[model samples]
Target: MTYLVNNPADFVDESIDGFVAANSNLVRRVPGGVVRATRTPPGQVAVVIGGGSGHYPAFAGLVGQGLAHGAAMGNVFASPSAQQIYSVAKAAASDSGVLLSFGNYAGDVLNFGIAEERLKAEGIPCRCFAVTDDICSGPADKASERRGIAGDLTVFRAAALAAAEGKSLDEVYEFASHANDRTRSFGVAFSGCTLPGASQPLFTVPKGRMGVGMGIHGEQGIEEVDMPSASDLADMLVDRLLDERPDGAASPRVGVMLNGLGSVKYEELFVLYKRVSERLEAAGLTLVQPEVGELVTSFEMAGVSLTLFWLDDALEQAWTAPATTPAYCRGGVALEGEPRDDADLAAAHEEETPDASEDSKSDAAGMLAVIETIQAKIEAEAEDLGKLDAISGDGDHGIGMDTGARAALSAARRAVEKGCGAGTVLMRAGDAWANEAGGTSGALWGLGLRSVGACIGDENSVAAPVVAEGVVEATDAIMRLGGAEIGDKTMLDSMKPFSDKLAEEVKAGTPLRQAWRRAAEASQQAADATANLAPKKGRAKNHSDKSIGHADPGAISFAMIVSAVADTLESLHEDAA
Candidate 1:
């Protein structure tokens, strides 16, 4: 239970503020996250790493000399938005390219991949890689699908060290990839973690039982079993990792990290590490500079993970490299570089608002009202949505939606105040939603809104045909960007139906308000129908059986938004009459 919290919505932001204040000597706050205070070498590749916020010491704490140049921090247990990643990369980038790395989670993959493409399009070299080292997340043959856990340290270190050595972008990427392939981690939780302001933990373990193969983000474990003694638990962890040793590993030496998830004390870890060391030595493997403490953590989770980094010659050299950061440090660091100039660290600025026709400005005001209505709907249903998502996912969907909708409303209001057009208002709102929400749904919704905005330009009055066209554009953009089909049990399940119904009604000359109401009805039906589906993508895919009776949170939220918009339109018509 997290006791110290003001507004749960502002927790991540406030925490980052305090973190930057305390670590100002080693790091400085950037727009999206934190960057190293010292300047990198002129031609060195910038190793930018990140993920959700709760996993402290992992992201911001790792930014310094011989480690990550920057970290794009996100919402708690949510991946950073593409805009956030782009901002961090731009701030940290030098003459050389940037290397983006993070855990192998769906949200992180989507957001980071988008950022990577954006950087390349802007003529900045960038490459993104996800660490897949958790042995129990997927079958051995499907190693790429495994979730990254405590083993992230090994891969991040290898890449950052190579970058600090002035290696090229390709070299840094190769090192990170190779490290990921050679690393393996396994963990178990005695109890689950509670998110800030939440009344209950995400998941619970029965008395005398332990959840095995647990994720750091409060994801339920794959299996539950009787709690074992410390010695037996160490053997269990050591044996699992040893069995999955990477092929072609000729070295007997390995780097070991016995990581505490959150609440586990250092004394307990040392006890476990003693048995772990004995087990590894007895198995004829040598441990080099083994770390036994909190590294990658889940906010107050009572769990531990064991990570083994099988080291070849190159990997060992990189592993031994010196580093100094807020939470982690190696042997003596020189601190030889000059402090980064404040001008060089300026955040990316929002674009200037464009002029709008009077009619378009009137439409913008209506859009603002619609956005406000959506925000209200999301806030009202957030708890129920989160409960639904917790059936198979991490249970943050409701909070994420509420956060995004509020941000969108704020941005829409600002755009309207500036006398912007409907298109500009929607586009600005979308950007704000993505930047603040920072997750898969955030990225997709942002893309969809931006697409609609592109179809309805600032100069034109929005009509039924134009609105239907914008819906089609939005649907197409979501499908293209998310790579999820209609039946994938995502927001598309509702969005596609809504788009199709609205287009058909408009083609038959239906009034815009009536057609939109009909479309919202169709969306609701589609969202409900998703209860019969087994998710084929995202985090729910890992627990498809558990999701069978629950509609996807994304689909439900989309339906809610459209229905709310329909009601808003009707209210406006009534007021005018």
Candidate 2:
């Protein structure tokens, strides 16, 4: 049921026959399962990328003008015979010579290694390049132990470029090797993929979870983490790529790829990219180019892989070169959507805004620092938060909070660098919090930031009354947008009471510090009360009584934040007085 194929025994050959038949103009079948381009361009060093047949658009589908010159095919998820390797190597080589690139596997090593010797004997200069980019496969002492996943694209592209440039056999070999060195890939599977015609999946990761570092053919992953949002999953994959990347490289331009295994939606791949871009930016890694689609796949697998390439000038140039094939092609860099100037947005504002001042800068920094501290506190309690969410929700609050907090800090830093006013700085930071933090948390957190921004306008320093107004405004937005009011067992239970108390204290002419302290205390009290209330929204809403004993994570988070805000205000007031 997992795989869709006519016959298990005829799977590999049938697939190869179909591919060659479909693209007779570009490829021709060679002896021993290898396929070569019908016409090899002279003076171009040829790259023949290959592997077991199941991972499509990989060793085989890549054969074209700027990609592979040929592909040595093997049985389904099995290594190709040595004859298969030799045929492709000899057939694809031209005056520019030939380079053999494949995933790093034991059988591939022996077969391709022998193929090289045979090519040399026939007076054909054939060199070998093995891709070892799957970071999930093994540790440093044993990098060779890893399997090749989506990182194969980087190697192929690099080799394609080197060959296209008319590089000699040694140069092309080195370029391919460099691509392997610069590349790193990680994969996660929601479910295992079935080999063609197989009734059962090669492996199974339990439902609602992901197997990180899973192999292309249903091998076990390093660990299984509860299924996270698209962004969270994307970040986990990107972070691993960033960490495992080779050093001493100029231009940390990444060729980010979100590869869908067989059945995932192409649009979902873009969603994956949206998260990937945020994570890459957060880590100070510049993405020179990004690719999103199914570049490689197992039959009917629900999974995605991220491949990062550290590009040099040559690699960048080659990747942009013209190329076309059956499943992939060079569509010139798609235009980034129309530009919007933030300055124009600010200018269009109907309200009068205050000029930036040293005082405003200080206030902005102080508030952000408070948020940063609150983020740290929340991060410390992530496990507990996740456990709570798991009980009646998606169990992502802990992860979401950590991401939102960091996003806020980064946004704050950018605002500070731009000499923005306190309100604008906080507004931008909040936007980052919403946009970068994935899922429902992003929506709520973003609304909170917008609410604060709406009230502050151009204020340089917060007076007791303005601070109270901002809190009240933020509370209102949370209520309207989140649709959760007091006793609804959500953040509003804490934020609403906190805002009212703050406003009352401010109107009574209480000192800002005292008003904040009262607000913080009231917020805490309300947050604790949520444990007794039935849930009313999101997945928690489904568990009406089940969520009764667990305090709403949003409420606890709100209380912790307000307490930090109160502490920050106290510090600011002391400095002013």
Candidate 3:
């Protein structure tokens, strides 16, 4: 349990503030995260890596010489918003290009993928490679689906080295992708990790038992068994990795990292690595640059993960590159010269106010009211939504939703006050929600809202048919962006139903209020029906069956918002009448 925190919600923000202060010599704070205080070589490509907070050294701590040029830090245990990623990447990009690297998770994929596109659109050469290195998450054939664990170190290192060597963006991306394909990681836990101010751990382990195949974020392990001796545990970790060695290597040269998740001390790690090293040698494998300490970590998870980077000649050279950072280092001490050039660090462009009609601005005021109503509803149901998520997920959904609703509401109100149109107000609100919430739900909601904004032009008339068409566009856009099907047991379950019903009702020429009511009813039914479904993504993917009896928190929240929007519409009607 983390006791140092003043408020759980403020943890991520405060930590980043403190981190930049402490590492002032090595890193400087940017809009979304930290960039290296040390300048990169001119015309060199920038390798920007990031993910959630809590996993320290992994993200911000590694932002310095010979490693990540910058990191897009997010909230604890959540993927960074696309807005955050875009901001960091824009700041981090040099004249050459940018290559984005992160662990393979749904939210990270969605957010980073979008950022890559946005960067490309702005003529900044961009590419992305997700590290899928966890061996236990999926079969070897489906290894691409595996969630990245500590192997992130290996992949990120290669990318940074490639970038530092002044490689082109394509070359850096290739090196990063190659490292990911050659890396594999597996972890075990004696217990689980407690989030800041949380009453309990994300998941629990039975006393006197250890969970094999545990994840860094307190994902429950696949197998639970009696605790083993240090030597036995080492053997289990080594043998599991050996069974999944890279092809075409009878005696592969490997770089090994035995990473402590959080609580395991360096002495314990050294002891475990002793046994691990002995076994690898006995199997006639050559170990190069074996790292035995904490690399990536959960808040205080009493667990460890072993990352094996099967190195070829080129990769071995890259892995051995000189690096200086707050945490890990290699080769020799390097002097920091300067931070990134402010002139070269591109900031986000100023948003232009599109011409909006007075009637559209009035509709924007209505959107603000709708946002307020949704926020209140989400605030009231926060605990219940969190409880629902806790059963099969990390249980952060309620807090995430509340955070997003507050930010969205605040942004919408500001836009309305500025006399912006409904589309601009909704777009700004969506970006705020995603940036503040910082998760899968946040990313999807941001995309959904933006889709609606795109369909409803700033200068266009706001009508029931246009609003219904916006819903249709939102449905298609979110489905494409999130890659979730109707039965995937996500917010889409409610969203698709609402969108379909709204479009149908509007087509039938029904009153806007009545059509919205019918759609809200459809959303409610779909959300309730989620109780019979199972999760196919995010934290619940591994133990999806456990979610069978509970409605998805995301779906439930979607239903609640739809109902609140209906009330907002009804209130609008009443005022007009």
Task: Please provide, for model 1 over 248-318, each residue's C-alpha lDDT reduced to its tens digit, 9 standing for 90 to 100.
Answer: 88899999999998999999999999999999999899898899999999999999999999999889987
Per-model TM against the reference: 0.92, 0.56, 0.95
Candidate 1 segments whose C-alpha is farther than 4 A from its true place? 463-469, 500-518, 567-577
Candidate 2 clashing pairs? Answer: none
Residue-level lDDT for 107 in candidate 1: 82
Report how far off residue 469 is in candidate 2 (Å): 92
lDDT of 2 at 421: 69
lDDT of 3 by residue, 291-366 (tens): 9887899989999888888988888987888888888678765765455655645575466677898777777877
Q: How close is candidate 3 to the true structure, as a TM-score?
A: 0.95
lDDT of 2: 0.71
lDDT of 2 by residue, 421-539 (tens): 67776677776675455345655665567567556644557567776788788777556544556777777888888889999988999888888888899999999998898975544
| TM-score of model number 2 | 0.56
- Report backbone clashes per prediction: 0, 0, 1
Q: Which stretches of candidate 3 lie over 4 Å from their true place?
A: 38-42, 333-338, 341-346, 349-354, 570-577
Better of 1 and 2 by TM-score: 1
Mark the regions of model 2 whose C-alpha exceeds 4 Å error after superposition.
1-4, 33-38, 331-577
